[model samples]
Each structure stands twice: as C-alpha cells, then as structure tokens.
Target: MFSGLPQDYSSITVTNDGWWPDTDVADFQSQRSIPASIKTETVASALLMAIGEANAELAAYQSAQRAKGFSSAKDVTGPSAGGVNQLCAQYLKIIFARAKAELMGEITSAEREKANPGQQSEDTRDRLLAEASFAIRNIMGHPRVTVDLI
Candidate 1:
C-alpha cells in the first residue's frame, strides 16, 4: 500500500539514548568552572558582536588595500589568503602589545604614586610588567584575524 512513497521509510529507525553520559557532563562542568567568571552566553554574545565589527573592519581595510593597490604574495597567487591573514595577525599582535604596555605603565605609575604617597614602590613596576606580559600572552593566543577568500 505504501509502495508509492519513499523506499527509505521502511529502513527508518529510532533510538532512545537519553541524556549525555555522566563523565561527559562532569568534564563539561569542570571546564565550565575554570571560566566561570565569563558566562557562556555573555561570551557568545560578545563574540558575535566582535565578529560583526571585525567583518566591517576587514571590509573597509580590504577596500583600502585594493584602492591603494597593495599587493602581497597571496595576491599574485590565488591561495595567499593565509599569508595575508598571518600578516594581519602579526600586525595586530604588535599594536595590541604596544598599547597594552603603554596603558598599563601609565595606570601602574599613577596607582603607585597614589598608594605610596611620596614613596616609590618597586613592586608596582614588577607587578605591572607581569600583568602586561600576561595580557600580551592572552592577546597573542587569541585569533585576531578573520580571513575571507576573495
């Protein structure tokens, strides 16, 4: 009677697997605890916003690059998008590191003066340098470029 329909329907099957295993849940929970301060929803929203902004910025940058006739190794070859992406990543790393260092140095100096009240604290310099190093590491580890193939 059902011959007029699809033959794959006869092979259809269903399984009740229920929820994920306890070990998987526990692992996920443990990982969640590590970044508990940054909620997944908030991170996701921020990432989406960042991606939108990055896309707009990339479009503008590429337009300028094209207008200026900026040619790279990838422009001559078709698959050089990776090279361009790497260049942008390197540039971002340098810029962010410099800015972070400068800003941290200024803030640390101001805070040290306020806290010490006429005496300079050597620890502040060490702490600020350490904090800046950590921030630079984080920024370097993060993906800074979104590459698109033209």
Candidate 2:
C-alpha cells in the first residue's frame, strides 16, 4: 500500500490509459473518423453536463442520508457509510471515464481531419479539467443536510 506517500500523490496521475492512445497521425486518421456534425465545444459541454448531473445526484444522496439522523446517531465511519461512499465514488469515476473517452473521440476526430482538422481545437486535457471543475462546483453547491434525532 501507499502508506507513507503524500496525499498529493493521488492527484499527480489523472489520465487513464483507455482514454487515449499513442499512435501516429496516419494510423489515427485511418482507424477512426470524426463525425462531421459534432463540434468539440459541444462535446466538451455535454461532458460537463453529464458529470454535473452525476455529482448532483451523489450530493443529494449524501444529504438525504445525513438528514435521516442515521449519520448523526450512528458512526458515519462504519462499514455501511464507507460502502455507500465507495459506490458513489465508483459511479463518479465511471462518469469521468466516459467523459474522457468522449473527449478523446473528439480529439481523434479533429486530429484526423474529419471534423475540425487543421484547426486548433480544445485538447483533451483542457476539456477534462473543465468538466472536472463543473462537477466540483455541482457537488459543492448542493444544500447541506441536517438530522434531527428525537
């Protein structure tokens, strides 16, 4: 395990292997073509929307749990809370992965000259970071839950 590593170590590596590939321009061009109808900005916006919705749902679920008095009366650090958080985290992770894949598709399409070829479009890194920021804001903006125990 990474017992002694700094907490910031977790933030250092963000890219997933499946999100992108190392291929030459010709190979990338030949393998897949970008859809003519889709724009990079549209793709980035869609990703932001999806991540925002997922994060909002997660925050709502957490707030509901807290409002039920279950979070206050019982040990929130117990197995159940941990399990729920893990499940939600996994869901968020999948959302992020899908977003990354979609951004990759846009990049590949653009690079292949299928849609916005030869144009300086938004790169994958910028798109992912934008979506992440949107997700973070969505989560933080949710109303906090309060529990009343009789």
Best by TM-score: 2
lDDT digits (tens) for residues 20-130 of candidate 1: 001121222232221223333433333233334333434444455457665531242222254444434433333333323333333345445346432234454455345
Q: How many backbone clashes does every candidate have? A: 0, 0
lDDT of 2: 0.42
Clashing pairs in 1: none
> RMSD of each candidate?
20.9, 15.7
lDDT of each: 0.34, 0.42
Which prediction has the highest lDDT against the true structure?
2
Off by over 4 Å in 2: 1-47, 68-85, 110-150
Model 2: per-residue lDDT, tens digit, 44-147?
A: 45445555555454565456656765442132333335435433343444355445545565556545643543333455446555655554444445333436
Residue pairs that clash (backbone atoms under 3 angstroms), model 2: none
